[model samples]
Target: MTSTMKPSYAIGVDVGATKIAAAWVELSTGQLGPVLRIPTRRDAPGEEIVADIISLALAIELPDNPDSALLLGVGVAVPELVDLHGTIRSQWNFPLPHLLDRLEAALSVPARAESDVRVAALAEARFGAGRDCDNFVYFSLGSGMSYTLCLNGKPYSGSHGFAIHFASSELAVPAQDRSALVAAIPEDYASGLGMVRLWQERGGFPLAQGIHTLEALAAQGNACAQNVIADAAGMGGRLIAQIVNMLDPEKIILGGGLGCSTGTYRTGLETEIRAHIWEQSCTNIPLVMAGLDENAGVIGAALAAAPPG
Candidate 1:
């Protein structure tokens, strides 16, 4: 690690349901290279996806040597449960294992991977909303949902790296023949994707328009879509309130595809949380937007290799 030597350059990637993004960074300078993006091959399977990822990596021409970059290692933020050495078990949407195998075989460098949501949480802890405090939680709501807890400056990966999967507003089913009770919960009222689906099914709007962007609908003030958004926010509030009750995180940051758009939903969500949290005022929890924004996943995944202390 000589000062005169050029800083080590590492590649950073974020693979999600929406996109597969990659970057080259100078670890020593905290300087990130130009970021690149490509639509995720939705439900893309196996080797083709890997080849697609490698192809994207090659698509970029960094300021420095690309061939030498891998020696510094590549860090990937993937959507599924990844093992300590970067083996993915299963992902709800699109998934894969041994991403490192492809990179190593193609280029010959150590690679690492972790859940995209958890990586985003890591980014928040290191340089974003959770900057000052440890033992905080980063929650995200979108097509899929999850939350990550950073305790004592380290991201909480859970026993099996699946902590966030349970926080979903839709999946928290009651035990036994308690269908009636589960139905009463707000989660059944909305999940991000469910809301969009409901607009077409129950709400009656020309929603099936080939429009892919959430922004496209948000701009029109489409009342039906608005209702769906509010409903989804309310559902999130319940899950958030419960996390506050159990962990007492110092800061609660929102993130993910929906996190950025949540300014559109928070007022409703805050109102719902205030009404439901049992000891609300006594427990002061701050719900702030993620400062790191969309890049949290890639940045956090990199930190997984050197997560916040």
Candidate 2:
């Protein structure tokens, strides 16, 4: 209220497989109020999840007045494919038949939803690492893996709004002897779950359940843990190199829980990416870590409902 620019607020919700996080965000400056998080009811009924999202949105306290005119609608980042019409086209963690519609009807305000990865890319484009680039690829290495193309400060939602699915690509480690290719899903080796599974398969450590656990073991000088992390990062990097060779984007912005960290994974991925790049000149392309932390998805979700200037 003290600033020259008018203040606008939107409630952003990130509905992940494990947790649902909600926050009140100032759209103009991308500043978030205190965040509220709760475990997601992944196996619960669809209506319960929708109700929980609405409950989280309503809990955000607004300034001046709780029901002020400065408050915009709610935006949600879902863990599934969302079409142009704000409809979740596929079932991922759970089935939500009509999510946005229910939210809007219950809250008596407009609501918009998009794929979580794409929403994160939009947040980066507007307020994070991709802001300076005209075209960038937001490569997310999380519990699962995916990516989004940010073009001119906007995320490119494909025809059906399901374009980014890089994790599904069947790729293989290059064979030195030119033998037959053995293709595997990249996520099974590079993603958080993938890394854990890979660790178990290779008999690294029986107790490593998540990627963070592996990181901790690696820090403690565990050779198997370190090798698993490095190998996964290398595969991730090689895939990124392929992206560079094809799109040649202005920048590659890394996001997600795993990609944003500055650890062995980061070093290994960068080295592998440079080695696999088809063009020598392209190898120098910047790989910027996303500026926002865990808040990126919520901030981005709110941006979807922010009023246009």
Candidate 3:
């Protein structure tokens, strides 16, 4: 579908497999209100999730005056494959394509949706970490993992929109006695869930706990905890550095569970990433923690619907 130009209060919605978050911004004041979250009825079929978000907008009652001659449009972010025209080709966790027409009908405005991580690069580059540089790399390691390269104001979606997920060869390290508990190519080792798993495998817990424990240990400088973190970052950095070397982003921003944390291993990731770079100057290239955390995607979605200069 061709994107029509419109003047409206941009409504940003970051729709994930498990959760849906919406935000409203009054453009003139530049004041962004608090984000609203909706529990994604993942079990429900189709349009239900999308409908929930539109309902959320009406409920939040942003702009206050619905009759204020302001055209209402939405920028939706999904965690899947999206074409330039906002066509979703394939999706893994969340598939709410059934609500496309209904959403536009209910909002009575133009709506655009793209991959969450991809639009996140746009959002952060425009408003957060990437604000200072024209070139940079972003890796958002949520439940799933994604990499986006932003140059100028646009995200480099590559030919298939999954460019930076390049596979890595196992970096040959000297043989050491690792327990069978640790998998070779640790798939469940880098995400939040994985971190919890790592903690459990190390014989360290009652096993059922919240994120604060993860944050607390990393903050406290636990060596075993830090090792698990370093392992993930070491693996992530190798993949990220390859993208960084190719794109030559001024900064490489890390978000999601492990990336957003402050730990000895987190610092070690920067050192490990610098080690892989051919040009050692990348050592100082700045691996930054995500400033806005998870909210970046929602804010970016709002920006997408806002008027462009």
TM-score winner between candidates 1 and 3? 1
State residue 301's C-alpha deviation in candidate 1, in Å.
Answer: 2.1
Evaluate all candidate structures by whole-model CA lDDT and list the values in order. Answer: 0.68, 0.85, 0.69
Model 1, position 175: C-alpha lDDT score: 54
Residue 38 in model 1: shift from native, Å? 0.5
Give per-model TM-scores.
0.83, 0.90, 0.79
Q: Which prediction has more favorable TM-score, 1 or 2?
A: 2
lDDT value, residue 195 of candidate 2: 85
For residues 1-309, what per-residue lDDT tens digits would candidate 2 score against the true structure?
575545788889998877899988899889888899998998999889888888888788866566443778899998788888777777867887677888888777789988899989988999999888799999877878888998899898888888878877686766777786777898888888788888889876566347778888888999988999888888788888988898999999888888888877788889998899999988899988888977899999999876377
- Per-residue error for 240 in candidate 1, Å, reads 0.8
| Better lDDT candidate (1, 2) | 2
TM match of model 1 to true structure: 0.83
Best by lDDT: 2
List the candidates ranked by TM-score, beginning with the highest: 2, 1, 3
